[model samples]
Target: MPVYVRGPKDIPDTVAQASAAASRVLQSIIKGKIIKSIKDMSLEKIETKAKE
Candidate 1:
């Protein structure tokens, strides 16, 4: 099933917190890949690189 999200003013505090957290996790996954793609194209290596 698909998920639906409502704003802070439209939902209770607990649901709003959960929705916000889910959004953050999705955003982080998308951003992490984009960052790795732009940096030396070294996404295939075993060792991890530090981000500054």
Candidate 2:
């Protein structure tokens, strides 16, 4: 997936670090598809898939 981390320079160091961590988690979870945005799917769909 195309993970875009924005405002790293403007935000605090911890914010950038957290964004990197979240990007890693997303990459690890969804390996096949390229997810541009979380809004593409419903929360229920995401929850159901996470269980699997």
Candidate 3:
């Protein structure tokens, strides 16, 4: 994933730091997807999958 950090010149840009941020972001997105997938509102029967 393309990682970007918005900070002043004092902030260090490193591979490890970028990777860590990317990991956290990916995790958060997946968690949010799963949470949203489980919350379905429909009157008819429908097939669904979680966190596709």
Candidate 4:
């Protein structure tokens, strides 16, 4: 069962967001070090890094 929470669904700065995401994914692919874990799906690390 899934519960849906409603809030702001629009992304701010969509182009920048897509570019950043694409870069991350490409880096993972290029390194051939991709693995599955909670960290792989986390945004907090990215957010913190962005804030620095």
Candidate 5:
């Protein structure tokens, strides 16, 4: 899955926050966990799982 980084609403703070978020995502990848895509999950399944 591709990772996406979105900036903050305030233009001045966007770059730093986006960089930090991207760095954190990269660190998670380095730890070997797969990033699951929400688009692949069905709404009913998600709701059921969340209720568990």
Candidate 6:
């Protein structure tokens, strides 16, 4: 999975930091594919497998 982080200088407000963290968590929950038994996998992995 791709990881995104706010640079120390980029985020200055406490509210913004909290909002970004929540957004990242929600995105992680909704953006992945549901596998049958193993954990949910990201769509990126499925696309890569299809190419192979």
The lDDT for every candidate, in the order shown, is 0.63, 0.76, 0.58, 0.70, 0.73, 0.66
Writing each residue's lDDT as its tens digit, candidate 4 over 1-52 gives 9677965446766777898999998987798545555466568865664464
Lowest summed lDDT window (length 10), candidate 2: 4-13
Which candidate's TM-score is highest?
5
Q: Taking the tens digit of each residue's C-alpha lDDT, what string does model 5 give over 1-52?
A: 9676964388657888999999987977797443477688889977875574
TM-score of 5: 0.43
The root-mean-square deviation over C-alpha atoms between each candidate and the true structure, in angstroms, is 9.0, 11.4, 10.2, 9.9, 10.8, 9.7
Task: Order candidates by lDDT, high to low.
Answer: 2, 5, 4, 6, 1, 3
Models 1 onward score TM values of 0.40, 0.38, 0.37, 0.41, 0.43, 0.38
Cα error, candidate 3, residue 47 (Å): 34
lDDT of 2: 0.76
Tens digit per residue, CA lDDT, model 2, 1-52: 8787864465577898898999988886688544567788999988876685
> Cα deviation in Å at residue 29, candidate 1?
0.7
User: Model 6: what TM-score?
Assistant: 0.38
lDDT of 6 by residue, 1-52 (tens): 9676955555458778899999886776686533444346578877774574
Instruction: Return the clash pairs for model 2, or none.
Output: none
- Between candidates 2 and 3, the lDDT winner: 2
Q: What is candidate 6's CA lDDT for residue 26?
A: 76
Error of 2 at 31 (Å): 1.1
Q: TM-score winner between 4 and 5, please give it.
A: 5
Off by over 4 Å in 1: 1-11, 33-52
Rate residue 2 of model 2 by lDDT. Answer: 75
Off by over 4 Å in 2: 1-11, 32-52
Stretch of 10 with least lDDT, candidate 3? 43-52
lDDT tens digits, residue span 1-52, model 3: 9666865444455766888989987987887643444346453323343223
What range of 10 consecutive residues in model 5 has the weakest lDDT sum? 31-40
Residue-pair clash count for candidate 4: 0
